[model samples]
Target: MAQWLDAKVTKRIDWNDHLFSLRFQCADFPDYTPGQFTKVGIEQDNGVVSRPYSLVSHPQDKELEIMAVPVEDGVLSPKLHELQENDDLKVMAPATGFLVLNEVPDSDNIWLIGTGTGIGPFLSILADSEIWLRYKNVILVYAARHQNDLAYGDFIQQCQSQYASQFSYVPIVSRDKADGMLHGRIPALLQSGQIIQQAAQPLDAEQSQVMLCGNPQMIEDAMDVLKSMGLKKHLRRSPGQISQERYW
Candidate 1:
């Protein structure tokens, strides 16, 4: 069982409509993989209830941060939505999960696919300096309901500027379309050959590796599409070229 620690909300950042970023202070928090999540227990009316949220900040940071979308019917999400500076919440520690770089084989091209707020961990992994040396081309494909729904726009642009030749950022907004951004769901893009066309190279299963994180349905859809393209599911015992983390 994980031990619960009481941490204060150091800051909160609103990331457009529906999503928010929360930074919490925890002393001596253990290092965690980017795609890992933590059970954040909320202070409720009668008792405390917790919900799992993916870690948004990179593990190297001292203060921990998480990006979340509020759910109305959720037991803990609403309270979390109302949180303010100095407010305290309990988090189950230390964080844990497998959708990280260590489980993946070192490769030349790495594809990080996500929908909605699921892109948090991938943001961390891609920003980390250690992973940059091993991977030649890093491609990020993010899909959201609207263009305004996209998060971390500035940070992504920074990556593009720094690693101009090595990094590629593709943002797909289904309901809201703009000139430069893809206008559809990620799976649809993959199936319609848009992603491949933009990639400018045949997405060969043998040479490419994929990391998926998002709503369960989206995760399932991505896995199926990739598998149909000959990509295999990765496992701890016998790893392959694809890995998934269902943010649900």
Candidate 2:
């Protein structure tokens, strides 16, 4: 069983009214892969209220980071949003998840598809240098309802600067297009061929491997589209083109 360790909030980033990232420091925290998730908890009068969050921080980063949108009147999130610098919480460390790169097979192109805070793990994966060397091209397709809901602009810009040739960032906004961002949902784009046109890469089972994270509905609908396009769900028993993890 994973035991809890006390952690102190180093900082909190308010990406928008609802979305935020919390950075904390914990002593003796175990190392974790880029896409893995760990449990965060708040001690209460009855017991600890806990939830799982994928790490947005790099393995070597002194602070561990996780992003989330608070749930109104919920047990944990609203309280989490209220946390400030120096506030203490609990972490169930030694992160675990299947979204890491090692699970992915060799491919000509790697597509990272995410929606909402599902973009968190992809940020950590992009920060690591190994991903750059492993694939010919890395395409990040981030989907959000509106422009303001899309966070981490600075880091995304830094990545575009660092890996200009090998990396491609695509932002999709469904509800509004104030910044003129590509308007539509992921499943719709996958079906329309517009997304592939933007990435300038073909998504095929033989040459492409796509990793999806975020909304269950988006994942389900997108998987249906990919399957119809001949891509199979990836598994340890039988590796194939599509790999996915659902984010609450």
Candidate 3:
């Protein structure tokens, strides 16, 4: 069980009209691994309404961050979007999730694939220096409806600077196109061999470790294509080439 801890919104990162990130300060919050998520909530007339959000800030950051996109018919996200700096809220303490790198089997290449706000955990993972130490190549694949939906370009650039020879970023826009950016859905790109081509790295079950985070359908479809390439769902009991987390 997790205890509710008091936190206050300290800042906001607005990427576009629909997507944003909230950074909140939780002085007493325990340190959590990259790729973990915490439940954030607010008081409602009936009770406390909460939703799980993947941590976007690295473990070293003073404030915890979570990316969000408002769901027109949902309960928590819309209200969360309306919150301003200093607004008090509740965060379930001792953040928990299983997508962290410790759970991953080391390999020559580590592929981090995410879509929409699902990119949050990957952001956290990329911030940690451990990633650079564990893999020879780290490829990030972010797919969104438009170029605007892609967040944190500056941070990605920083990683590229530090690991110019070891890092690759593949940005895919489905509903829009931009020069020098790959445009398509992830599963299709993988199936057609465009993703690896753009990254200049092959997706081989024997040599690649793929971590997927996104909508269930995308994960589901992408896994099928990966399986065709000899990749299998990873499990501690029987480890394989692929691991996935469903953010939506």
Candidate 4:
């Protein structure tokens, strides 16, 4: 079992009206693998209420970061949104998950698929230099409702600019049409072969590794599609072609 650790709010990165990034400083923090999540608890009348949040920073960082989507009616979410500098937070557990960088084998191409806040873990893993050197090409497929809903857009752009040849950001907007960005959902792109065209290469099961993170429905759909294409699900004991971290 993990112990509750006291952490303080270090900074916040506001993505939009609904989304914000919360950074916390945990003293003598436990080491965590990329794609793991923590249970953050709030002091309530009866006891403590907690929610699971994916870590957005690698273990190397002294501080840990997690993104939050404020639900006005939610008990913990609203309180999370209201956190300010020097505010205290109680993390009731250590970061834990099977979906992480260790599952990925050395490959020529890697596909990181995410929707909404599910992109957090991928962002953290990709930023690590060790993972970057293992794969020749890193293709990130990030789909959101609108451009404004896409978090960390500027940082992603900077990463692409810095590693021009090795990185690819395929932003898909479902509700709005934007210049130089893919239109429609990722499922549609896969169905119409647009993703392949945009990728400029065939997505072969043997040559690629795909990491998926998002809602249950999206995860199911992606699993079906990738399975049909000969990709296999990976686990701790048995590694395979596809790995998933269903945040929901």
lDDT per prediction? Answer: 0.83, 0.93, 0.93, 0.83
- lDDT, model 3, position 118: 88
Minimum summed lDDT over a 10-residue window in model 4 is located at 196-205
Which is the better candidate, 1 or 3, if ranked by lDDT? 3
Model 3 agreement with the true structure over 111-175: per-residue lDDT tens digits: 99999988899999999989999999999999999999999999989988989999999999999
Candidate 1 lDDT over 88-199, as tens digits, reads 9888899987777888887778888899889988888876886688788888888888887898899999998999898878888889789888988777788887887775
Provide the clash count, candidate 2: 0
**Candidate 3 wrongly placed segments (more than 4 Å):** none
lDDT of 4 by residue, 1-248 (tens): 78888889999888888889999898856888888888887767787788988889888888889998887688798999999888988885678887687767767888888989999988888778866788888889898889888888777998889888988888888899988778887766876778767866556677888888987777788788878788888765776788888776
Better of 3 and 4 by lDDT: 3
Candidate 4 residue spans exceeding 4 A from truth: 236-238
C-alpha lDDT of candidate 4 relative to the true structure: 0.83
lDDT, candidate 2, 145-185, per-residue tens:
99989999999999989999988888999998756368999
